[model samples]
Structure formats: C-alpha cells, structure tokens
Target chain A: MSTVTKVSSRYERDKELFLRYAAIIESSDDAIVGKTLEGIITDWNPGAQRVFGYSPDEVIGKSVLILFPPERMEEEMDILGRVAKGERVENYETVRVRKDGKRIDMSVTVSPIRDSSGRIVGASKIARDITESKLLHASVLEAERHFRETLDHMLEGCQIIGFDFRYLYINDAAATHGRHSKKALLGRKMMEAYPGIEETEMFAFLRKCMENRIAQRLENRFDYGDGTFSWFNLSMEPVPEGTFILSVDITNEKKLQVELEKHRDHLQEIVNERTAQLQEANRELESFSYSVSHDLRAPLRHINGFVELLQKKLPSSIDKECLRYLHVISSASSEMGHLIDKLLDFSRVNRASINKSDVDVGSLVRQVIASLAEEAPGRSVDWQVEKLPDVYGDQAMLRQVFINLLSNALKYTGTRTTAKIKVRSISGKGEDIFVVEDNGVGFDMRYVSKLFGVFQRLHSNDEFEGTGIGLANVRRIIERHGGRTWAEGKVNEGASFYFSIPRFIEQRG
Target chain B: MITRLGRILLADDSRNDVELMLLALGHFNLANEVDVVRDGAEAVDYLYRGGKYAERGGQNPALMLLDLKMPKVNGIEVLRTVKNDPLLQTIPVVVLTSSREESDMVSSYELGANAFVVKPVDFHEFIESVKNLGFFWAIVNEPPPVSRNGGEQLEG
Candidate 1:
C-alpha cells in the first residue's frame, strides 16, 4: 500500500494541473496557439478562434502563415526559426490579417514548446491587438505639431524662461525681438543671448515675476552696442514652470512726445523776446515826444515874441515892405507853433493809458456841431445826424475823434453856400462803422492815401486852413481803440470819412 | 492904477526872456520893485537871503514867477524848498513856462504852485499876460506881512 499507491496518486495530480492550464488559456483575452517549426498550426484556443474569425476545426491543420499579411510572411518564418532554436521572442509588434480581410496592429510573443525527451517540437504563441494605442500615439504627435505652428505665427514677442534663467522656448517673434535666432537662444542664459540683459530693468522685472509668482508691466530702453537705442513695453507673467514675457516696441511714440515738448518751449522763448523788443521801442518813442513838446516850442515862442516887440516899438518907422516881411515872419512862427502842438498831441495819443467806458458818440457829435455853429454863425450849414450806437471805448478819446472829423468837414466846406454834413453808423462784421459824409469842397481822391499820414496835406494852405494833423490824430486814436479809419472823396463832390470800432461782447454767467 | 507892494522875484534862464519880462513890467511902472535872477539857485538864494543876497536885508517877495527849465536848480525843486520853509510858505509862486506838457503842469501844481501859466508864443499875448500878472500880484492880491521871526503868518 506504500510505493505503488503513492506513484498512482502523484500521476493523477499532475494530469489534473495540465487540464486547469488548458482551461485558463482558452478563456484568456489573448490569442493562444501552438504551431510546428514548419509554421503549421497544431493546436488552437478559443481566443485564437475569436481573434482569427475561424473555428478550431477549420484552422487546426492550416499553416500559421494564414494569419500573416502577404508582406509579413517572412516575419513568421523568422519568428519560427527563433522558436525552433529555443530562443523566446517577446512583444514583437507587427501587422496581421483577420477573417474579414481587414488589417490590424498586434503585439506577439513566441516560445519553444518541449517534449518529455527535452527536444523542441513546436512554438506556443500569444498575440495582443494594439490598434487603439497606435491611434492615440499618432493623434498626440499631430497636436504637438499644431501647437508649434501657432506659436510661430504670433505677432507679440513671447518667450519661456526656465528657473535657471535660461531660455526653454522662444517663438519666432521673440527670436526677432531679441535680435537672435531660436537655435542660438534656446537653452542659453538671458545674459549670454543679450550680453547685457542682466543690467536692464526688463531682466529685473522678469526675475521678480518668477520669484514672487506675480505679474508685472514695465517700459525699458535698450542700447544696442552700435549707438542705437530702442524702447519696449514689457509684460511678464509668472507661469508654473518659469516666467512668460511679452514685449512691444514704443520708440517712435516716445520720440514724438519729446519733439512736441521742445517745440512748445521754443515758441514761449520767442514770444518773450519779441515782447521785450516791443517795450524798448515804445520807451524810445515816449522820450522823443517829451523832448519835442518841451524844447521845440521854446524857440518858436522867442521868435514870435521878439517880432511882436519890434512891431510895437517901431510901427511908424517900418516901411510897408518891411512890415509885410515882419508879418510873414510872425505868421510863419505861429504856424510852426501850431504844428508843434499838433505833433505833441499825436504822440501823446500813442503813450497814454486807455480808460474804457460806454461812450455816447451821438450826443458828443451834437455838442461839437453846436460849438461849430456858434463859431461860424454867418454860414448856414445843414446837419444830418443819425441815431448812433453806444460803443465801449475811452470816452475822452472818442470825443476827440468826433471833434477832429467834424471840424475838418466844417473847415473844408467853408466855400459851400449850403454845406451838408451827415453823421451816420452802420453795423459791420464784428464791428460798428461810422461814416461822416460832407457835401462841401471835397478833396482830390488822388491824394487819399496821404490823408491819415502825419503832416501829409491834401490841400494847399490857401485852399484850406489846416496844419494837416487832424486826420492823422483821428486815425491814431481809432487804431488804439482796436479800430480802423479811412476816407473817400472826389475832386468836387463830397468827402466821407469812415471809421470802425470793434464790437464788445459781454460775458455772461 | 497899479499899487506898489513888496519886491517881486522872477527866475529865468534865458536872457531874452528876462529882458522881455522886464520890458513888460516896465509898462506897469512896477519894474523897479521886481528882482531878476538868472537861475533857480539865485532865486532860492534871494529868498533865503543866502549866497549873493546875504548882505541885503528884506522880507520874502510878494510874488515869485518861476520858469521850470532852469540851470543849477529846477523850478520844481525851488518850489518844493520854498513851500516847505515856514518863512517863505506864504509867498505866492506862479509857474510861467514855455513847456505846455501836461506832466509839467501837474507837477508844478502838485509842488504847491499857486498858479500854472503857459508862456504865449505870440509877443502881444506874452506882453499882455505879463502885464496882468504884474498888476494882479502887486496890486489886487494882498500878501502876508513880513515874518521877522521865521514864524507862521496867516493873512486875510
């Protein structure tokens, strides 16, 4: 009961283990098969029938070459050779054919099967389908290519910096902005690529953004070793790996702002210089007028005074010719005196301070006319006065203007039996124009340009008794009030003098 | 009829002007009582009894006719000095000048000048104005009595 019974029991246990192994192989998801060295199928499992789309009876005697594509038949021979030599092939990926004539990707392992005599007779092969994994790997490669293309096409300069302050990735724009190629910049330190970026505010900002895990924006000027400078608007963001940077050029805008500021300062300097020169000229004119008023009149008075004493002391002793000569001297001296006085008056108008108020021009003219009528009671003059507008100006200066113009009309029209003087006003663009029309012995229009010039005369002393300063004074006073004056006349018709004053616009709250 | 008063002082730089003024005063028979000084300094000296007139004994003149543009001291300076002095403040001073400048007139009045007159260019008007000035100051306008003690003398 010992030796014979123990040997029988051990043999039965070994047979049971072989049946369990076969059961596991048949139910596995992998295709398990046994083939001979000549590549003929000897045994097939349920997984092999499921994968090849063929049942066990149909493929039991078929060659293993039936499972290979036409171009891969040589691969099977090579695999069978290795298996026959007792060399195991593991996970050798290749193509295979299914029952439906479609191609599939597969990974296979082949091992030599041995008999009890220790001689290799066939190969046991296991294959796994890998089509889904191959498809996923191909799609991942395509996505990487798309991302690289998008970075190359960007407008802003972009760069990725490593924690070691070296370049990890740089786009096309970033390479151009840095004045370097991507091949030269990648894996290179910022100082190595730009040579002096460590000294620049841009490098400092990037370092700060990386260290503090914050975002920052700044402007910096870079000097390229060739004596040229460029300004950039830099923005840096802290990324998980390192720092991301974007840069934009702003050199032209900075240059334009500096140019505009220079022009403004230059214009202000020119204005100050011109104002100083004008003030100097005005001071000289004032001194000249003061001297003319004081010194010039003294000699004229002495000449007239001595002549009068001679006439009074020797009235009977003087001959008619001598007396006439003396009279000429006296008259000429008096005329010179009058001329001097008028000249001083004209200059005073230029230097006097202007005091402005609402002035009644119509009533002032009426008063002047009444005085003229009283002075020339013998002559009958027709006066036509219009309703005049009140203007803002120096009242005394305006009165002087009216007096001069009206007196000129009265003087020129002395020859007329019925002299007509018309004073009227008309509204003009941004101003009020007053015209004094006289129907009298009018002046020749040929000398109209000389009317407002100082000491310029339109008529001889015999024709009109005047020192030729009234119109000049009238022009000066009007000009000081920000107005203009002009005269129009014919040889014998009438003369009309026109003057315009700027209209005042009142400020309202 | 012109009544005689205290001495009249006239200050002028021009010889011809002084001669004419004297001739005009001669017509009023008051020329002897008038004193003529060549410059403003002489006028001041005559009034203060200093310089050349220190030896002479007199009171302040009843009227002083001052010309503005004179050498050594100007009429404005002379007027300022005389008006500030207590003994000479009561003396009437007239600015008679050829300058018709408004600033000169205003300054003369501001300096306590009793009258401002522009000398006429015509000889007849000059003579007539001088005659009227002589008669009015020497006869029509009464002057304060002589202040021997340099004291204030108010006149009616």
Candidate 2:
C-alpha cells in the first residue's frame, strides 16, 4: 500500500497486458508487422510470416519495400508518408509481392505506433488478401456489360422508365422504332420526346400498369402528321422503378386485314346486285313463255284449222293452184307452231328447277336413237354407242340434251347412204366430255359460231327440214346443268358435237 | 250413227276456236246436242241454270269442255265450282285449251277435272282428238241421270 509499491504493481500489470496483446497479434489470421518511419521492418508476427512467406528473423531488419511489388513500390512510400504524419491509412488496397515472388491483391491499414512519452516512432500495419473479392467484382462488371449488349441487340423495342416518367434506358430498337435517337430520349421525359404519346392509348395503358403494378397489352396506330401511320402492339409491365415496355410493329398485318374486310364487303354487294338483276330477267322470261304457249299457238291453230275446213268444204270445187296455195299456208303455219314449241322448250330449260339424281346416260341415248329411227324409218343408220358413265343431274333435262343431239345427228346424216353416228365419252378436267360424232353432210366451219344460236340454220329447209332450234335447246339444257356444248365440223366431211358435265362424287353422311 | 245421249257444253273465249270445235263436232253429226258459251261466266250460268238459260234448259249438261283462258272466269274457277257442288259434281268436266302450261294442268287435276286435253295446232290431229272425245263421252261413257230438284240423283 505504499506509493512506490503501487507504481511497481501497475508496471507489472502493463507488461502483462502488452504480452497478452502480442500473443493475440501472433495468432490472428491477418498479417501484423511493426515498422519504422524510415520504412524498416521492426517486428513481424506469425500472421506476417504466413502472408509474406517470411520468418521473423528474415524480415526483422529488412526494408518494408521488400514486400512491395516493383510497380507498387511508390504505394508503400505514399502509405508511409501518411502514417509518419500521424495519420492512419485505412484500407489502402494495392498489390504486393510474397517471398516466393508471387503477387497478390491486398488491403492494408497503417497506423502510427506511439511510445510511453506520446511521440510517434514507427507504424503497425495490418494487411488482408482480397484476391477473391477482386475476381468477383470483375465478373460482376462483365455480366453487366453482357446484359446491356443483349438489350441493345433485341428486335423488339424495349424501354425502361423512371417514376418521374423520364426514360432511364432505351434499347437500340426502341430508339429506332420511335424515330428518335437514344441520346435524345435517354434521361428525357417520355411525353417531351414523343409529344403526342401522352394522349395515346398506349400511354394510358402503361400508366395503368405502373399504378396498379400489373401487366397490360395494347395495339395503337401512331399517325406521324405526314400522311403516314404506323401500328404498334405494345406490352407493358410494372417494374420496381416504373414500367417496362415492349413494342412490336404490326402495320402491315393490320393493313392486310382491313383490305380483306373491304374486299369481302364489296364482293357481297356485287352478289346482291347480280341476284336482283337475274330475278328480274327470270320474271320476263316466265311471261314470254306463257304468251308463247297460249296466245301465239292459238292463232297458229286457227290458221291451220280454217285451212283444213276450207279444203274439206270444197275439195272438188277448188282449183289446183288454190289448193297448192292453201297447202303452203298450212305448212307455214305448222312450221311456225313447231318453232314456238321448240322455243318454249328452250326457255323452260332455263326456268325449270333442276331435280338432281343419278342418270343412266347409256339407256337415255338408246331411247333417243330408237325414237330417231322411228321418225326416219327408211334410213340405214349405223349407231356406235359407248358405255356411258352415270352422271348427277336432272334426268329430264339430260334426256332432252341427248334427244336434240341425236336428232341432229340423224337429220344431218340423211345425205349419206349409210349414216354412221358414234357416241362416246372421255374424261376431261373435272368433268366428263361426251362426243356425238356423225358421218353426215357437215356444215361449213365459218358458220360454226352460229350453230347454237336460236333460229340459226346452216342448210335451207328444202335440204333438211328443221326449225333450227334443236342445237340451241341442247345448249340451253346443258348450260343449266353447269355443262358446256360446242361443235366441230368441216364442209362435206363430218361433224362432232361435244358437251361436258361435271363428274359426281358420292357424298358421305 | 252418233247417239244423242245428253247435251255437251263448250266454253271457249276464242271465236275461231269455237268455230273449229263446232266444225269438228259437225263431222260426227254430234253438233246439234252441243251448246257453246262465250266465256267462263256463261258456262257457269248455263250449268247453274241461271242468267240466260234459266227457263230453256232441260237438265245439266252431261259433259263440260272448259277452256282455261277466258274473260270473266277461267276454266279452273268453273271446274272448282262444279266439282264442289254435290248436285253438279256428277257431270264429267273436260279441260280443253290452247295452253300446255304445267301449272294449268296441275291446277285442273287438283280441282277434280275429269280430263285435260291441249288443243293441237295441227287441224287434222285436233279433229281426230275432238272426234274421239265426242264419241267416247257422248256414245261410249254412260252419263248420270238428270238432277231435277237440285239434289244428287242416283243413276240407273
């Protein structure tokens, strides 16, 4: 309890604390060293030996410059200059060299060591190897570059906006699609850059997505004030800061859709107008058929009837000339009547409702040939009929077609002593083409165009007695069944009539 | 040699058609029993014993040859009236006309017409058809007895 005894005990306690601090520094994982203001190594701990690869004896009197790499030698001086001025250099990251001559990244802290008199003597430095953290930082910077490059090369327009509606980032596509430069858009308000975008539906959708933290998609047309417009499909999603947007150009597709709709409307209008006109024409044709069947035939019957009465009343009193005149009148009236009947048949082919069924073409042709044979009893005609395929059409209309064609064949072949008619069928494009060829007095090829015209006759009545409406009737009937009729002939050689009908495919239920 | 069974009623609007029909009937000496009316109204009156022949008729005609196209009423209307009447329905109604329209033929059949014949444009064919019709209706086919009290009469 004396004053001197107390001071000596305090001194012993201070030495005990210093030894404990020394033990702690020696067991640390970091390097701890004591050096002088002149940059000489004074003390080195076990951690310093482990990090610098040097033992305490090897580095106790060496200059600290031995641990500095040649390129970082000035770093030691700069650190020492600050430490000698009683300033602590904290986290002075630089490169250093090991005893084995390998270099490593290090983070160092240097503090001015003080004596018992409070005067700076040397410095105590702590260092840590930071090579892993340095490599991690470099990799992080490389990934950021890759992400920016990927955004720049995307085809779809991408843009990132801040909460203040300013463009934080705009990809290359977004800048080009918006018809503006990236330099002009970045860090600029979106409304200021596009001017009219604030009033657009795309802007509204983007704002809604941002406010509600949701995603939205919209299509809008941007009119450029010049006569040009562009359509865009915009997809917007709420991000952390504001909204992220992706835009795709759909101008061409939208234009094509609009044009197709317009064409469809135009076609519908044309079909309606054509149907109305066809209905009107059918009404007129019906009235014409009615008049021809009744009023016209009545007059002709009266003419023939009166002539017959005149002949019956005064057969013996009538002179030969008068009788001959009466015969002409009667024959002419009968001819007119025949013409009217054939005309009505032709018109009926147009007006009648087509009842479709499978028709046997071969049997129909045979029946027609037999009727023609009965009409021309004395003619020696050789008929060659092929095995015809069944067709789907109106049976009666097809029968009429065959009747007219066969009758024409029999009549034209009257000049030949042995008339030969060949009936055959060949398959055509999507149809069956039936040919009726005859070795007859063929018509001139110049008048072939008029063959299917009503009242158009090639030969005079004296040569071949006909009303000249048979082929016309044949054409009308075939046309009603969605078929076509045509002829091929040469003068005095032979003639062939050809008609085509669509092939029928069986329908499945 | 033609039997005078019953009166034949001929309804035609065309004068020439009527004259021809009369001549055709005269060929068989059956014209005396035949009575001609100008239009369908007269035909209806003659059958009903109204208008002109109310006092002159003995009984309803045995056969009526109705022309389709007439001025006041058509052949179809006259056929409809006669076929619906129980008293007059026994008479055989034949439609003879210039029209060969399918609608006319279908309507005639639907209205219970006994026969439909188109007048031929050929005079000889017309005469032959008329002769056959007159001979068959007047001489071959039996006629119903006269209805005297506007009631259906059982035929003997």
Candidate 3:
C-alpha cells in the first residue's frame, strides 16, 4: 500500500513539469507540434495554431499532410520514413499550405522522440517562415545567368584571364578556333595554350597592360600550327580582379592596306612623269622666243642701211613724195626693231639668274630720278624723294625697277606743266612698301588688270610714245625679287604705283 | 697736186656702193686719182704691191677705205695684217660697214682702225655721208706722209 502511494506522487510531479513546458511552447513564435511515426498530428501548441491557421482540437487527429503542399505530400512521406530511421532532419525548406490554402516557404527541423524502451513514439518538429530569403536567392541566381550569357555571346572575341596568366574564361567563338574545349581551356596559362604566342609582340603588350593596369589594344600576327598566319587586333582591358582581352581577326584588312600603298606609289610616279613633260615643253617655248628675237635684228639692220643709201643718192632726183615714203619706211622699221627689243627684254627677265646684294633703295631712287631729268631737261616737274629702307635684293634688278617706274612717271606726266611726282615709303605689317605717285594723265581704273600685260596700252600710240612694255618688265623684275606690284589710277587726276618687296630675301642670300 | 693725185684704193663688195662712191669722188675736182677693189683680197694685194697691182700704182694711196664683210679675207684680218706691217701701218685704214651693231663697232675700233661709220639707209643720207667722208678723209684730215721705199708692202 506504501509503494502505490509513492508512484502516484511521482506521477503528479511529472505532470506538473509537462504543463510548464507546454505553457512555454505555446508562448513561443516558432511552430511546435507533435506527430506520430505514422505521420498523424497528435499534439499542437498555440504557436502551431497561429502559424498553420489550425486549432489544437482541429489538428489533433489529422494527418500531418494537411500542412504539406498537395504536390509535395508524397515526397514528404518518403522523407519522413528516412527521418524515422533515427536520422534527425535539419533545415528542410519546402513549400507548405496553410488553412486558407495560401502557400508559405518554411524551413523545418524535426527530431524523433523516444520512450523508455527506446522505441520511437513521436516526432517533434520546428518550422520557421523563410519566404523572403528564398525569393532573394532566386533573383540573385537569375542575374548571374544573364551576365554570363551576354559575355559569352558577344560578337567580339572576349577572354578573361587571371594575373598568373591562367585563362578563367574564353567565349565559344574563341575556343572553337583553338585546339581545346572551353572546360580544358580554363585555368591554363596563355603560353601553354598557344605556344608561339609567348614570343610575339602580344606577349610584350600584355606585359605592359599588366604593369600599367590599364587598357591597351595591340595589332599582332599569330602563327597558327598549320603553317598559316593571321593578324589579330587585340584590346586588353585590365580590371582589378583580372584582365579582359577582346580580339578581332584583321588579316584581310591588312592585305587591303598593302594594295592601297602600292596604288599610292603608282599614282605619285604618274604625276612625276607628267610634271617632267610639262617642264620640257615650257623650256622649249622660252628658247624659241629668244632665237626669234635675236635672229630678226640682222635683216632689219640691212633694210635700214640700204634705205639710207638710197635717200642720200637721190638728192636732186627724188621728189617730196619719194622722200616722205623713204622716211616712213625707215621710221616704221626702227619702231618695229624697238618693239622686238622690248619684247625680248621682257621675256629675258625670267631666264637670267639673280645675284643678290644689300640694295640701298633711297640712293637707287635718287639716281633713277636724276637720269630721267637728264633725259628731259626742258620739262618742269616737282620731284619728291622719301627716306627709303635697305632691302636685300639683286642690285641691278632693283635699279631696273626704279628706272622703269621713274621714267614712266616722267613721260606720262608730260601733259602737266608743273607736274608733281612723289616718291615715298610706308611700312606695312611685315613688308616695306614704296610708292611712285604722279599727278599725271592717269588711266581708267577699270582696265587696271591689263596694265602689267605686254603691249597693253591705255592711250593712243600717238599720244604716248612707248612700246608699252615698261610696266610688264617692272612687274617681272619685282616678282623675281619676291615682291609684288600694282597700280591705282583715275581717269585724269593722278596715278600711284605701289610695289612691295620682302625684306628678308631668302634666295641667294 | 700731182703727188696727191697719184692713187687711191677703195674696197667694197656692193656694186651700188662702189658706184656711188665713185660718183661722189668725181665731185672732188682735185687731181687725186681713185682705184676700186671688189674685196679685201684685192685690196690687200694692191696695198702689198703684189701680183696684178705690182706695177699700176705710182705710190700707195693716201688712205684706204676698208669694208668689213667680204669673202676670202675679212676686214678684221686685213686690218690686223696691215697694222702689223711697218710700211702699211703708217697709212690710215677706216672701217666702213652696213652693220651698226655695237659688237662690230667696238671690234673695229679696238683693232686700231682710224674710224668707223655705219652706211646710212636713205639714199640722200647715204650720198651726204659719203660726201662728208670723202671731204674729210681726202681734203680735211691731214694725210700721213707716204713711204719712199719702192717696197711699200702690205701684210694681209
């Protein structure tokens, strides 16, 4: 009777500790439930009631398959059979159905509980909601796949390599031309994959890219094993993790470049040949003109000499008409001779070599004016001489320029009784400009373009006695000195002729 | 008068010029005689007292009028030979030519010719120049004395 009383008291204490554990499990947020080894739900705490939307009374006799998704219930039974073999399952994440048929992701930890005889009595399970973490993992996997697809499928051949010269990745196109598969290519050194590539400029170029840790593009020739060679345009982009190379085959483009260079050389040869022919023709024309002028003088001299003899012998025998005819013929012959001489002079300016010296323009102008005055002492004119600069030029040629200009001024200003002629100098930005201005019978400005052309005249021959070659000759001489000449004039007021010479005479200096 | 009228030598290639010269010489009524040669060779022969001209000339002419352009011996060669000879050097040789080119003028003067004149083209001017030349050389300018040795030889 004492033993039975003792057993009853121990049972009461064990029931109290069980009630305390149940109260703590009910207050927890984690779903705590008990299932039979046959997969039937027997015990459910308030935490399980809130999590699965099922009360303890409603789930006590139901199968645990009520919480599993319909598609996964059979799979759960197989997994539970494994768990019942004394294997505790941890972190088994799966989709489950709640009371309202809503799906939720839960990570489950289940342990098999044992009785005094060590036989499995039930299974205790702890399930937690992890839906947000599962969705985040899925998006990360999708982004990684997208990045890999774009890099592999890009049109330009791309390769990623580690600093140890090991290739981490090569696209499908780059691997196809190689002797190895993409899997075998990874983790292989650059030289080991392509043996001769180490000796090429590409090797040095990659070294530079690595040292600078910058992007570089290299044009190099790659000799394939089959005795064929190809040119590759390689772009190396250095990243902190590794280096990326983008290669393009440019062999056909290089051949086109060589052909273009040959074509360019041929075109230059044609131009050189044409220029030679033109220069030969020009030289022939110039010599022809020189001979025509030089030989023509002899015959005209004979005609003049014979006519003079005829005039003298016919003193009493000739009539006034005959004398006048003889005078006219002689005069015409002389004028023709003068014209030919002037033409030759104009043409010869280009043929001669220039001898340069320091020319004092001031004294040169004075001498020219004095010579002109001596030629026409009877004419009254006011001559103005200005201070002139020293220029580097051929002294004789410069003297010829001043002589022609000043003489032309003196002759044209004949109509004015007290003609005023001004010789002055002015400074231009980088040149010395001199002007021989005359208040004389100026010409129409509209015909100024014709002024420097040989035999171009603005006045009637009877009015102005000239062969009309002076200004043309002057223009030629000044141009040869690296200078320019031009004139401005009105109908009758005056004319000013300006010419400039570069002070720095580089040729012959 | 008799000595002055002794002889004169004219060398010219043109027939017309020679005829005019003779007519103008005719105007000078002095007792001076005139002889004409067609080229420099004949002139050289007559002055050197050679071949055909050995016996015709009583003495060398007072002056020789030399025309420059002729076949065989040219005027410059003739002048050079004459001036080199002791007997012929004393007699003044004047260069007369149709060429008025500066080279011809300068060459004749440089060769020790007494004077150079371009033959004028007009007929009247030609006659007047010849008349003036004749009056000046024949009458106005004093003539160098003639050589007395019968060996009055020319070198050209």
TM-score, per-candidate, Cα-based: 0.65, 0.68, 0.55
Model 3 per-residue lDDT tens digits across residues A230-324: 77889998977578888887878998998899899899999889889988887886656644553454455456656766787786867899999
Give candidate 2's whole-model lDDT. 0.87
* Residue A29 local lDDT, model 1: 83
The Cα error of candidate 3 at residue A109, in Å, is 4.1
All candidates: DockQ: 0.56, 0.66, 0.09
Q: Which residues of candidate 2, in runs, are more than 4 Å off?
A: A1-267, A506-509, B1-7, B27-37, B40-61, B77-91, B143-156
Query: Which candidate achieves the best DockQ against the true structure?
Result: 2
**Best-performing candidate as measured by TM-score:** 2
Q: Encode model 3's per-residue lDDT on B59-122: one tens digit a residue.
A: 6566778888777888888888878787777666778776544556787878788889766544
TM-score of chain B of 1: 0.90
* Clash pairs for candidate 1: none
Q: For residues A35-122, could you state the per-residue lDDT of candidate 2 as single tens digits?
A: 9988999999898899889999999988999998888788878888888789999998888899999888889999999998978999
lDDT tens string, model 1, A32-115?
A: 889988888998888887778878898887898888899988998899888888999999998889888888888899999999
Q: Which candidate, 1 or 3, would have the higher lDDT against the true structure?
A: 1
User: For model 2, what is the error of residue B86's alpha carbon versus the real structure, in angstroms, after optimal superposition?
Assistant: 5.5
